[model samples]
Target: MSQKNNKKRPKSRSWRGLFRRRSDPHRAYREKYLETLQYQHRTFDVKGLTTQGIFTLELARVFVDLGLGQMGQRPSTDPIPRFAPAQQRERHSIWEYLTSESLQNHNLAVLGAPGSGKTTLLKHLTLTLASPESLPESVQGMPRMPILLLLRDYAAIIEEEPDFSLLTAVKQELARREENIPLDWLAQDLQNGRCLIMLDGLDEVAKPQLRRQVVAWVERQMQLYRNNRFIITSRPFGYRNNPLNGVLVLEVRPFTPEQVRQFIHNWYLANEIKSAGHDDKGVRLDARQGAEDLLVRLRQTPVLLDMSVNPLLLTMIATVHRYRSSLPGRRVELYEEICEVFLGKRHEARGILYDLTPAQKKRVLQPLAYAMMLHKQREISIEEAMAIIDEPLSRVSPHTPRNEFLRMIENTSGLLVEREVGMLGFAHLTFQEYLTAVHVLDQRLEHELVQHI
Candidate 1:
């Protein structure tokens, strides 16, 4: 009986081992995916593939959990169902241009009117740079992950500088749990010729003076790190030929009506694929119908292309437009309203003040105006703006001193961005426009009132 029991136990143990050895489909897929990525690393001339190493242990876990590598994970059909000829041309042109030797000499400056997908393009470019599959063999040899820094945040940090090294500030930013980025490894990789920086929203930085400083700082850093590249995006108003005078500039043209329709169609298809687990016949038909409607609505303007769906700017526009009627009708008016709001005064009172104190107001508003216009039309330094304003630096304030007028503008709008303690400018092109509108309106009103008197 003991021998029989022992024989049964051995059989049971054998059965258990066999069951454990049976392959897990999901695990096998993950292994294959990782193996493919690893195999690609061999083709690169990388000194050491630390970028892949860090990302494999970090982002891969999250991507796997999200089923990115699963057999049925990607939609059966192309996620983007349609593309216009013009869009194809534009995309191809951009890709070709970036791949050109000019790319090496030029840090990309993407300029577009507001709501023209400038930020989206930058985000897409960053993703492309990060993607293992999309990268060239040479780029794969590099070891650093592309870093996208929002200029507004960077400006804020620089303003609050307490002797912190730039490297330390960058580390804190890269070490977020969501990003799970390895900063030390990244820095080492950068040193090894493996990193790119995508600095977005140059136009969003509130102050013109700070913008110039930021640009100068970036130029200096590029000199320091010859291997790394930068891509900057901004609206045409605040980021023309200022500090980036000699840099490679790419204008983001508004999508043509046909391009707009195609983008809307693509967006609808992507949304449908994301929403539906699989592309059933019904889902395809629904996507087609949605795309048709979206295309029609999006063909009016490049901004409307964004409004056909939810994007950050579209949401802001929708909210603002609901209060007013139409964007075009209210563009200048809304700017004026924003100026009044930023200035903490009613429009009527602001007008009255312009009439009551022309010289004092000109002294205050002109410097701010020149700074805004300079930053908007062309990127100009604060020192240059100061020269234009011709204000004695002593009068611009450091204490409770009476004559410091620019501080008043800074204090009112919270838009004044100081790169260092004493240096300052408006935070964004929108703010610049606001300040510009106030200055222009006040000057016009002062002129009219004087004529009446």
Candidate 2:
């Protein structure tokens, strides 16, 4: 009976084990959590054309190859509504900006246009600080625990439950992927000034009231926890108030020509490694050739090169060009090829019995696009959209399902997006214009152009 009673307790629950864990409870999990975060944030998915058809690549695998970018700090002396830096705002390498005294010294607000890689910039900081394999030479100092939260999620929670605690929101975001991190550990780290909290996309909160709430909550937290470093990102338009205290403001400059060149080269290398699974030497060689050739092609298309400074447009251009590698060097050919890519999205071979042919579907969108242009409307109501698309779709597919067709366009092809809850719009104005031209030309409606004008 004594032997049974004295049987060794599991090592995990032993008194010594309990004391050891208590002595440094947060350290054990915090270190593990940092590694977990590194793994989770290290890879980013890029969706577009690849050698092996539409693919998503780990863009960060080659992030270092492109090098860290610089941010231009907005001096408060600069007048409000002044863009283009009337005076040269001080520039710092993003790595230096984060690791130096600046981050610990003052809260930061980074503003840029949509699609200028604002999220990527914040994420780069997150990935680098969270148990990085190596640090950029420009970076210095000890690592801080990174806590990345989308402000939209918090806004959503608050929109639903306005009284939700900010700490609870952070805890919820941390646990979102079932990370199972202890709330106590997070709170302790935050209190001790060990966390780098990044709140991304003030613009995405969307509703004005919700954005105000988010702004207020952030300000409150900053006031309460002055020790911890914080970073906020948004579009230039979303952050007009300049509400946060002692915040350094910065803007993400457009990618320089050298940056554009390097980013594309590494981007393709990442894609080649991920999609084609080529040998390293072969992959590098192909990636170099592919990137250079793409640049040459883009250079020929002035319209594309003009938008290349934007990382989002640059990525889209790379994706579209890779898919349409054989496009004839003509302006019309570029638009036509783009249309073809949109037409060939997952709808082409869903293997479903009700799948509509890409050509038939394209025709329906073409006329609808034409109608939007005719009305000078950015978006159309769902009911008006059905009325326009139904007759055209019925002409091609007598048994077409109206709701399913709209769903395919919205979800699968991404040709049309829900601009509002019930209003549908072409994904881009260019899409509408190109499709309008196609509709007018193909259907012999050129005469109507003069009448509409």
Candidate 3:
């Protein structure tokens, strides 16, 4: 009996030590979490065409200043009222703005137009929060676990079964990192203001009714888990009023000229690093030269300057300029050329083979674009999208399965992107709007053209 009790004592001590380590939130555990985050996100996760390296540093370097301002008039297609309650605002970096005393207790609603770097900014914050090496002075020594939840994924779950808990999602995510803190312990941590919850893409919830539910869920979470920091991101037109009582609303400012120059330089430097590892030294020199040339052209062209304010568009411009040595002057021409390149030249360079001509591809896409416009939806489920796509596809390739063709398009065309398991949206809202405009032109709706423009 004495020997058995002695054996159990050591085993009990080991078990207790395990719980102790899990309960102790410190720098060592935080380092592990940061490693996991960096691995999961990687630089390829950036929106649009994936830049080759861990360009998080580049993103941070080029990070534009965010400003407070009255919600300006949005595009006609997106008529949702501004959500910010105040008229006065100031510009600040993510580090400076988020670390303020005013925002410590209040949740933040970050609103921007599509392709305006809202998602990228949130992701950069997440990576920074997790990484001790990159921690800004404001967030340094702040022992908080940053959990990023995609609102679309949460909404999909909510739509399937209304009883899904956000805590469950958090638990599953933490489990990925082997940090399975008890639910009650996690809740206590949140209530104690030790967690940073980043809810990304509130606008990505496709249905209005569904989005309202998500908004309500987020509000409930904020209220229930009081004192925790939360940053929720959404497009300008998709945002409604403050769902949380003390939420701070912020808008991502367009990139300024100097910021654009910085981004171009960083972008090429990162690409040069990527090329140096696998390609000839000449490739790196060419990349550097191309970036310098592009910057000069951007300064010379006012239209491109105005368009390049958008990070996504700027990246595309850089990409096109690298290969083609010129940019289209008109917005419509740019989109049209981009579409053709994505369908043909880009795919060819990547060694992907596609049999459909650009015209046939456009024919198949126009119907879906029109459908999205009619529905006023940015994303749709696979079932409905396929149903809408089947007719046009059947006419083009009678024997091909619609699902197979849809996969081909998704795999090849960077324009249409899969957001979640069953949801598909345009890679950027600009693409959707441009395609819709193309459809409208094909229909010769002159009055509607004025309205759309």
Candidate 4:
């Protein structure tokens, strides 16, 4: 038996000089807060591959540090505009430039299309900042307390508490670990130019009025914490109306063929290393061979290869290809397979059941997607969404409660996403477009669609 085993779960951690911007008077609480951030951001949560026996991958092990550039000026989802390939010289490696002094000195807004790795980049920065040992050159001697916040959470908080400021949010974030931190600790840090403020997913704010408030709030914080580093992320369209002044806009460039190859190699190698649980020589040759096979398949198929540039979709392709050993050549077939992977395969793997079948899940969501496209809204409130989905649900799942269907769809299917409190939307814009087109064709709404066009 073990020796009395009394470790009491675990605290965050103890790190030497993690945020060396200055000495902390409240060392205990500060370290605890930093540890929490480190734990939360230090892993890549890859989904839909549980059957492959990989649920979480280490952030440091597989992170590829995809470059940033002026990939495109618009957020349009058209292939050319959204995913313009970047030449080597035109982009800056995230490994080299992410925490460079020049970037740290100025505020920045990183915009990218859906699944283009904007959030991943922020999380990478968070994880590295949390653990400076991982990025010695990138973050050493320039450590700032990495305060990462999701803008959606910010919006939700402020809506309930009108007096909630960024300062309050940070304090609350720390307080959640414990209330031992002095009230002046964060303020002193902010005053002394010692914080890296990262706000992620501006597009997820959903409501326009609340978005305006969030932007204004950010602007206010930038002014108040004039010396601290700030980085905000969003899709290009979400930021077009109220673009911040003096903040550099860097678009997340898609993975070029070379980067794609590197990511594939890294992903497989990392998985093999994790599965084998050792680093002995020849522990796993499967990673090297499997990466080659996946790369070959992508190289042979133009559409799949083109889709490989986007990191999230490419990751899905890699996971799905590994399990299935083949890829659908057509974009439509690929989308259908993605839906099946998310809606059916995921739940099947977990032995979970729902009232609606995979096809019926799509059936209920098609009209909602059609309505969203018709009105030019990517997200709808839960009430409005339930109302729109009511008719479709009645047709497919009359016995199922609407809220129960919504809950199952959110939990099991993974196609419907809640961007924020009381808000719902499709996980991807491409999914919405495909479902909307299906709806139009099935209902013979060509004339109505043509009129709108």
Best by lDDT: 4
TM-score of each: 0.47, 0.65, 0.62, 0.68
Ranking by TM-score: 4, 2, 3, 1
TM-score for candidate 3, please give it. Answer: 0.62
**Least accurate 10 contiguous residues by lDDT in model 2:** 1-10
Q: Give me candidate 1's TM-score against the actual structure.
A: 0.47
**Which is the leading candidate under TM-score?**
4
As for lDDT, the candidate ahead, 2 or 4, is 4
lDDT of 4 by residue, 307-334 (tens): 7877766877887776655565445656
- What ranking emerges by lDDT with the best candidate at the front? 4, 2, 3, 1
State, as a TM-score between 0 and 1, how close model 2 is to the true structure. 0.65
lDDT, each prediction: 0.43, 0.63, 0.62, 0.69
Evaluation by lDDT, superior candidate among 1 and 3: 3
Q: Which pairs of residues clash in candidate 2, taking residues 3 or more apart in a chain or in different chains?
A: none
Clashes of 4: 0
Which digits, one per residue and each the tens of the lDDT, describe model 2 over residues 1-453?
001122211111121222246467566676667777666666653433222335555546545212222333321111011224432234445555555542445667877654466677767777776644364444434235678877866776777775676578766766776776666866765676666788887866656677888888888887666667788987654676535666777766656567778878877887777767664788788878889998897777655665576675576677656666752254465455445545553212222122566677788998899999999998899888888888888898878687768855664344677746788887567678888999999989999976999
